[model samples]
Target: MNKTNRKKFYDSQTWKSCRKLVLKRDNYLCQLSIKQNKLTPADIVHHIEHFEDNPSRALDMDNLLSVCSSCHNKEHPEKGRKKDKRRMKSRRMMI
Candidate 1:
């Protein structure tokens, strides 16, 4: 596994709420690869960290990025947010 361990920042409801705050902070613009591309708000909120399991960093506005779906999918090729969440949740159950 990647030792980078990005999931360490999403642990509580705080992360979800923080995500909303960050989205509003960025004006719904994708922080990643959005400087030139013209896209709509239908994009995704790309988390700076691949894994979001740590609350402290999860709510950090700096750690969140408002990205469109295309950019978000490009960043994470195989796993979607919903799938990732489910996988992460199941993994937690085993631990």
Candidate 2:
């Protein structure tokens, strides 16, 4: 999605509720990390399929994923929030 549409979608009540549901369903844990045998706290709800490419599944629960800042950035490098190489390791909770 374009920046304007993306912002509006994120700011909507529908997305707010959907995000909460996805987080709860995933137990607030990063789903990708779990698949790798690492447990991490999830702080963002990500689209498994890019909403920009497939608008029809924008609000589909099956297309949503609970992820952490690190994982989300990995999935969307265009976000330009790549981890700082000079910074210390993140202190995000892990199990």
Candidate 3:
């Protein structure tokens, strides 16, 4: 889907309700945090199968994971790492 359509889907009641259900199912705790024996509150419901790759599974509970921002970034680091690399290169140039 295009950006507008994707945004509309995310803003829809269906997605909101599903997001809440996923968060509740995960007990509002980050699954990654729980695995590491932490108790961080989740702020994102991530798509395990990636919505971009499988839009049909976007609202699938089984394909969702409650996660904190840190865990979410770690899970999807392509954008984050590229930005970080750019920043590092810029810093090196400055130095």
Once superposed on the true structure, which residue ranges of model 2 sit more than 4 Å away at CA? 81-95
In the range 19-63, model 2's lDDT, one tens digit per residue, is 999999999999989999999999999998999999889899999
Model 1: ten consecutive residues of lowest lDDT: 1-10
How much is the lDDT of residue 75 in candidate 1?
78
lDDT of 3 by residue, 1-95 (tens): 78998899899999999999999999999999999999999999999998889999999999999999999999998866978999999999999
Give all TM-scores, in the order shown: 0.56, 0.79, 0.89
Question: Candidate 2: TM-score?
Answer: 0.79
User: Which one is best on TM-score?
Assistant: 3
Model 3: weakest 10-residue lDDT segment is 74-83
Error of model 3, residue 46, in angstroms: 0.2
TM-score, ranked from best to worst: 3, 2, 1
